[model samples]
Target chain A: MKKTPLNQVHRELGARMVDFGGWDMPVQYSGVIEEHLAVRQAAGLFDVSHMGEVEVRGANALAFIQQLTINDAAKLVDGQVQYSAICYPEGGVVDDVTLYRFNGAHFLFCVNASNIEKDFAWMQQVLRESALTDVTLTNRSAEFAQIALQGPKSVAILAELTDVSLDDLAYYHFCEGAVAGEQMIISRTGYTGEAGFELYLPASAAVAVWQKLMAAGAPHGLLPIGLGARDTLRLEKGYALYGHELSRDISPLEAGLAWITKLDKDDFVGKAALVAQKAAGVPRRRVGLVMEERGIPREGYPLFAGEREVGFVTSGTMSPTLKLGIALALVEPAAAGLDGELEVAVRNRRMRARVVRPPFVK
Target chain B: MEFPEELKYTEEHEWVMVEEDLAVVGITDFAQDALGDVVFVELPEVGTVVEAGKAFGVVESVKAVSDIYAPVSGTIEEINDDLVDAPEIINTSPYEDGWMIKIRMADAADVDDLMDVEAYQALIAEES
Candidate 1:
């Protein structure tokens, strides 16, 4: 398994390590609930170095990105980031990514760690097929380290380390600056649905940056978060995870990503298929579920409406903040109405559940 | 991790405190530490019968879920109702207030098959 630049630092902090998508990452430091609550209430630091960074540069960068992603890349200004997805020809999602626009001729795509190699190969294949000669694609996944400082107190803690006036860094905007004497890209974004920033810097400078942030954040109740809390925080906000909410078999339309899938835009990969699927109406829809009974709903557990199996859960947990079992499930569109009665097959019993819009906590 | 010297242990990390024919059962400190923060617990009915070494209930944490096995075959006489509302007690006091169920032993001799404190410590050491 591959290790991130901060692997030794995590170990030194007594983080419980686990194998996450072939990367030895910290699953928890103090505990999942503690780390999760800290991120919601105060601030939490996360080592997200395993995430992939692919640079697309050259004169045809805009054209290449336009043909590749589902969202309108032309809408992005320099230093602005957009959440988008690449899809297969069949309209199934290839990977959901964050596209950072540096200029019309340069862009950076941050992709899920598990899909790094596959996404890079796919991009290369598409470039070759399109004959886009002016565009140069480089896989810089190993050259950069990313850290997320999330929660309400994140800005206060990070402001102590950098001179960049964070108040002017609007959401989804980024700026190049020095943090702890290391050149870094400070992006005002995060997965935790809280005010935060994601810092990207050279891999070799990860330890120094992490230590400085940790020391500065100590006064603000910042905890070192792990993948375990990352999942919970995202789930609470109704965010989609790659393997669960999307895959080669699940279209972004069915995954509730229609906002990002601009069918009216100029021709792009999967546009026609997505348009056709939309006309036909999405057969399945993703919905949030809160257990009305005792058992915790888990992934792959079947969902039932009356006596018929409607769909299955994608991600579920006993929410640490809510103190209730909450889940995200893909069910038949007709059966996904809010407050709809449903049941989840947990263990040997069918537990009662209710359909509700997510952001379950807020 | 603390293991009360008087409590007998099962290889599954359950601790049994024998009082004549009744045995109070709960998970060990090591087990609770591994499970992290407990969020919910599903307990069997008080009158339900359980088999030795069989799964009787489930203990859920924020990240994972585990089955709590019955160390000895018996009828459940009582359960810790407080855990349904505040399962985190399992992390704070695994051996005392977090006790899952009290069982009326079908065979008192079943205690002989469980490991004593010293043997249980050795088992944990070997596994680690």
Candidate 2:
């Protein structure tokens, strides 16, 4: 199993370890609910070093990125970031990624850890088929480590270590800055809906940076969170995960990512199929369902409107904040409207659930 | 970790305390510790017939859902209804208030096949 730079740090903290896509990672430190609630009310830090990074450069980087991702990279200015997706020609998703544009000629792609090799290969294939010799792609996954500091108190916690003015860093923007005496890329974006920052630094500097942040954040009740709470936190905001919500079999349209799909933009990978799919109308819509009964809805559980099968759950849990079961499900369009109840077949029992849009806590 | 000497234990981590023909059943301390915080529990209703070595209920932590197996064949006499609303009792008081069910045993001799405190401790030791 692969180990991140903070593996020993997590072990020393007595975190519960689990295998996540071949990486031996911490699933929880204090506990999932504790870490989750702490993040909601105060602050939390996360190790996201397992995610892959790809560097794109050359004069045609903007053109290549615009031609590759579903979102319009042409709309981005220097130091701006865009959330986008890469799709197969069939309109099935390749991966949803965060694209960072440092300049017109320099950009980077942060991709899911599990899809590193596949996403790189797909990009290489697209570059070759398009025969854009001005574009260059480098797999820099091993060169960097990533950390996320999230919640309402993040600005105060991070301010203790860095001189960078937090007031000027807008959401979805980044700057090259020194944190804890180490120069790194600090981006104001996170998977959690809370105001947060993601720090990208060299792999060797991870331990130092993590320790410094932990020490600075100690007085604020900031906890070192793990993958278990990460899932619940992101799910609470209705943010889609790669495998569960978006995958090769699921399209950006079906995953409710139409805002980033940019179908009207110049021809990109999978545009024709998406155009056709849109013309035929989307078959299903991703919606949030809150349990009206005691039973907890789990992934793969069937959902029904009356007696007709509408869809199935993609992700679910008993929200630590709400103390109620909430789920993101792909269901028929008619059921997306919360006018009536939907039944989730939880094992042998059919439990009552209602369509409630996400951000389930707030 | 507290596998009582007077109680019997199963390899699946369930504990059994025989009270005449009724066997008091619940998950062991080690099991609850491994499961972290218990968030939801589903127990069989009273009068349901259960077979030994079969899954009769479910226990869910925040991250996982696991099966609660029957230790001995019997009919359910009572269930811990408090667990449905306050499942964290399993983490705080796994042996007493966290007890899941009481079964009127179809055969009392079933306890003889289970491990004692010493044997259960050795089993968990090997696991850890």
Candidate 3:
């Protein structure tokens, strides 16, 4: 299995290691709930170096990205980030990505780790079919390492290190700045729905940056979180994970990403199919479920309303903050479109659950 | 981490303490440590018959749902109902308050099939 640059550091911290997406990564440190609560109460630092990055540069970067992704890259100014998805021509999702626009001519695509190779190949295939000669595609995942410092105390802890104007760096915006004596892309962004920063640096700088942040954040109770808490934290915010929420057969609209699927824009991959799907009404919709009773809903668990099966759970977990089971499920739009009661088959028995909009904690 | 010498152990990491025909059962400290932040536990109801090596209940951590297997064939005489609402005790006190069930053993000789503290310790060492 592949290992990130901080594998040794995680081992040093005695984090329980697990195989995650073919990578040997820490699943927790101290414990999942404790580390999760720490992020909510104070601050938590995460090693996000395993996530992949692709650099797209040249004369027609914006146009190439606009055709390649679902979101409108034309709207992105320099040093701005846009949450986007690359879709199959048939309207299903190929990969969800975070597009960082350096300028009209240069851009970076931050993609999910497991889909790195596939995403690059797909992009290359699209560019080849489109016959765009001006665009350059480079997989830069191995060249970068990223870290996220998130929570209520994030600003205070990061203030002790970086010279960047965090105030000016609006959410979803980024800037090229010096942090801890190293040049890095300082972004006011994170997977956790909290005040945070994602620092993108050279792979070689990962250890120093992580060590420095851990030291600076120690007084503020910043814990080195692992993949387990990361899942719960993102689920708490209703963020769509690539494989779980959006997959090759799951469209962005069905995954509750209609806002990012710019159907009104000029022709892009999957736009025709998405527009047709919208016109015909989406067959299924992604919705949130909070257990009204005792059981913890798990992935692939069937959901029902009365005798009719509505859908199945994509991801579910016990919310560390709410102390209740919360889940994201894809269900028949006609049945689960409204906020109402549903039953989740936890195993042998059906458990009472209610459909609630996400951000389950707040 | 703690292995009481008087307790008999199963390879599945359950500890059984036999007193007369009745046995108190709970997961080992190693099991709870492996399943971090246990959030919910589902135990068989009283009077339910169980077979050895079969899954009778489930223990859920934040990220996974794992079955708790029966270590010996018997009927569940009593269960730790407190675990329904406070499952983290499995992590905090797996041996004491976290004891999962009491079984009226079908065959008292079943206890003899289990390993003692030293053997259980070696088993966990090999597995880990």
TM-scores for all predictions:
0.98, 0.98, 0.99
Highest DockQ model number: 3
> Model 1 over residues A298-357: C-alpha lDDT tens digits?
999999999999999999998878878899999998789999989999998999999999
Segments in model 2 whose C-alpha atoms lie over 4 Å from true places: none
lDDT at A90, model 3: 97
Q: Write the per-residue lDDT of candidate 3 for residues B7-120, one digit (tens) a residue.
A: 999998899989898989999999999998899999999999998889989998998988888888899999999999899999999999999999998998888889999999
- Residue A55 error, candidate 2, Å: 0.5
Tell me the DockQ of each model, to 2 decimals: 0.80, 0.77, 0.95
Candidate 2 C-alpha error for residue A316, in Å: 0.7
Q: Tens digits of per-residue lDDT for model 3 on A22-137?
A: 88999999999999999999999998889999999989777788899999889898989999999999999989999998888899999999999999999999988887778999
Q: On lDDT, who's better, 2 or 3?
A: 2
Residue pairs of candidate 1 with colliding backbone atoms:
none
Pairs with steric clashes in candidate 3 = none
- For every candidate, what is the interface RMSD in angstroms? 1.1, 0.9, 0.6
Chain A only: give the TM-score of model 1. 0.99
* lDDT tens readout by residue for model 1, B7-94: 9999999999999999999999999988888888889998999999999999988888799999999999999999998899999999
TM-score of 3: 0.99
